[model samples]
Target: MLLKKLQLKAIDYKFVLTVCFFLFFAPIVAAQEIIPDVVAEKPAEKPSGGKLKIDGIIATVGDYIVLDSDIDKGFLEITAQGGSIKDITRCQMLGKLLEDKLYAHQAIQDSIIVSDAEVRGMMEERLNYMTQQVGGDINKVVEYYKKSSVEEFKTYFADILKEQKLASEMRDKIVKDVEITPEEVRNFFKKIPKDELPTFGAEMEVAQIVVEPKVSKEDKQKVIDRLNAIRQDVLEGSSFATKAVLYSQDPGSAPNGGYYKMTRKTPFVKEFKDVAFSLQAGEISAPFETNFGFHIIMVDKIKGQEVELRHILISPTVSDAALKEAKERITNIRNKIVGNEISFADAARNESDEKETRANGGTLVNPTTQDTRFELTKMDPVLYSQVSNLKGNEVSQPLLNTDDKGKKTYKLITVTNRIDEHTADYAKDYTKIKELALKEKQINAIAKWFDAKIKDTYIKIIGEYKECAFANNWLKK
Candidate 1:
């Protein structure tokens, strides 16, 4: 769909630049003020032998300054991430840098505080990823980034990351309250010429009833006991990180020694947060069960509302008998639905084990669009494979599924709605059309905010950069 394509482009524009900026680490130079109309001096004659050119400030937006080297660094960052700089220019990089500075500066003026702990946690994760990329060699990271040591690299990037975070928060604040009404959605759709109406891809609404293999009490106890044993080892002078690496079943944290920093507002499960917040620094929590598995957490430090901790998770092993039983259960449910003895939605509500879909009568909401319809081309590969061939009210045979956490389940799926490729219909595609309208409204709000801010905020473009055209009025003219 043209609307879908626009949405993808907008998302790429929003995130790609920020990601490129963070990928390359550079030294921040001091700001030097120059009169707005003053032209920067050209370099004087050099010796026959080549000499290094000096870096200087090219532009200043509010309290932040853009360095000549920053443009070069931006190019390097993009190239490092496999992006082409063939069509990119220094002027374009400078414009982006100026925008980011404006946002960051405005954020500080608004007293938007991003805590040091949050920045430090992000810095650590980035550093770990970098080091891992270089074969787990910290020295390679320093050498690749041309830093004298790891600490210097961390310090420079930490400041950069903080500014980036501030800029992001400020940008979000600009359009946070922007909303669109039904009239606006209709008007927005009406503005598109009939010949230009976007064609939506073939899509279908799929529903499923899942039955997870149940873990026996003994199997669950075995997991709890294992976590307890690991906790005892940590208390008796073994490294918790080492134990986590060896035994924790949580793939996300196991490699990083199960480290996580969290506050009360963090999205960790309530059971996990309760146990973590209840423990004092240096105290190890008793084994506890959550939907993911069982975990034993040790609080490393406490800073106000935030706590740094390490945890090891162990999921109970499902017996083959349990898997077979799950398959049989789902198969029976499918047979009942096919035979018309029970309605599919009613069976899901009464018999499905998956809490997420059970209450919704097994209907799946597409994560991307937050709707029931999934565009065939854009659907997740695994889901497409399962439901692609089904037509009408044909219920699929029980299919075994493995989740990201390696949990096993069996499901029966059916397609409730299917729409062939067609030009956008105002009444039928109202939800999608509304999203497009809302996004346009939000973009306008952001543009207006930036226009007002540019006037109120101090900005100066110097030298040859003053000639380059920018989407925004950074020169305040």
Candidate 2:
């Protein structure tokens, strides 16, 4: 739903519909493309100590009541991103929020379930993204939200995130199977006036074959030895938390001194959880290996089936020789493909270490679209720059980068097709135009759904808000 508020230029059909629905209805304010820096608004002064406004129910839809503070919060959030608050804008925001509520309510009736773990995972990802946006300072983020700790902020926003996710899923269900035929796409393009056609930027279908350097057993042993030393130090009275903060490679937990709250039900790797749970409180475990790396865990507390633990993880270093070997391997593979000794797809299928792309013969899928095509602006700078100069069917020299798992690897890129910036065309841009048509169809379908839904659901607006103009048939009753 936050994505619905953002303007996106990429050509993912799903996201195209997401933002398109918002585009169909005029917004209260121009929504910010980035996450707004939400700051709480102090109330207008009434007396010596500025009497705060009491939050009360301002509207109701179905079983849900929209609180005045909800509007205030929305106002603060949108206006923080440079939106202006006025009667019209407030009304528009209320309509959107009501629409969101309707979806959430309907989701409940449909028996759609969103798990707590999924919500928590998404919350963590969003928090991590926010942390990165603040230049990796979690403290600043906490300060921005006026929260004492990261966990406090998570607790505060957890419900909001869950609602947003539920609303999005509901919206997706409404238009999930929306499609447009060739004739529909052609007719849709024809409907666009000659002077008003949308222009698209240069995009490419790029593929890559990756080669990860294998860590030698000797280097793996070195990592094991280092972890053993750290374990010995902890056994000799060194603080496990201090050692973890100093040396643990797991960034997600290292900042908290490798602390985790886990239960048997909590989804941790069996190897990690088993060792963690077996240890007595304040006991340290010997170094053990997981897919991420070698780890030595300390059990801080155990409450029934739940365990509180701290761990120090150390990833084995990939030697320069191994990196060189990876580069050499990719280079040889690239040469073989270029010399026609092997096809690029065959080489990718046989040799690429990237599991996600390997099955598709190294076709790089756009995370948003699940397609091989990508808008150049959306690609990583290194990937874009390397492929920018290459013609269709040309391959790049071996480039070094970390893979999705954060392992160092060497890769070669091939640009299969390139489409330059041009006004939308029926022949050349069928998929793009079809998505646009589908979006319009989705908008109409949703509008009809809303008309029927609002008519059936109970809606009560305060007298003050009743004066504001709403774009929807919200006041039809």
Model 2 / residue 461 / CA error / Å? 1.4
Top-scoring candidate (TM-score): 1
Q: Against the true structure, what is every candidate's RMSD?
A: 7.5, 8.7
Q: Per-residue lDDT for 1-477 in model 2, tens only?
A: 222321232223343333324422212112323344453433221123432346767678776778766755665554544544442244555666777888877777778777665565556555656666667776766675557987887786677667766777888888887777778767767766766678878888878898988898998999889988998998899888788868988877775567777898898888998898889999888888886778999988776876778898888888899898888889999999999999888999999988878888888877765566677777768677888888778888888887443668788988877878889877777777777777777876777787887787778876456555554666764
Q: Which regions of candidate 2 fall more than 4 Å away from where they truly are?
A: 1-56, 78-88, 115-143, 146-155, 177-187, 190-195, 217-317, 333-351, 354-363, 391-395
| Winning candidate number (lDDT) | 1
TM-score of each: 0.80, 0.64
Model 2 lDDT on a 0 to 1 scale: 0.71
Residues 1-477, model 1: lDDT tens digits: 655655554654554455435433422111011111211222222123432245677788999988877777666565555445555556556767887888899999999988776676566556666666666777766665567987897787888889888988898898888888899999889877788788999999999998989899999988888888888888999999889878888766776677888899999999999999999999999999888889999998898998989899888998999999998888888888989999989999999988889998999999999989999999999999999889798999989888888888899999998999999999999999998789778776867888989999888877667766666798777
Where is model 2 poorest over a 10-residue stretch in terms of lDDT?
A: 23-32
lDDT of each: 0.79, 0.71
Candidate 2 vs. true structure, TM-score: 0.64
Measured with C-alpha atoms, the lDDT of residue 325 in candidate 2 is 88
**lDDT of residue 101 for candidate 1:** 89
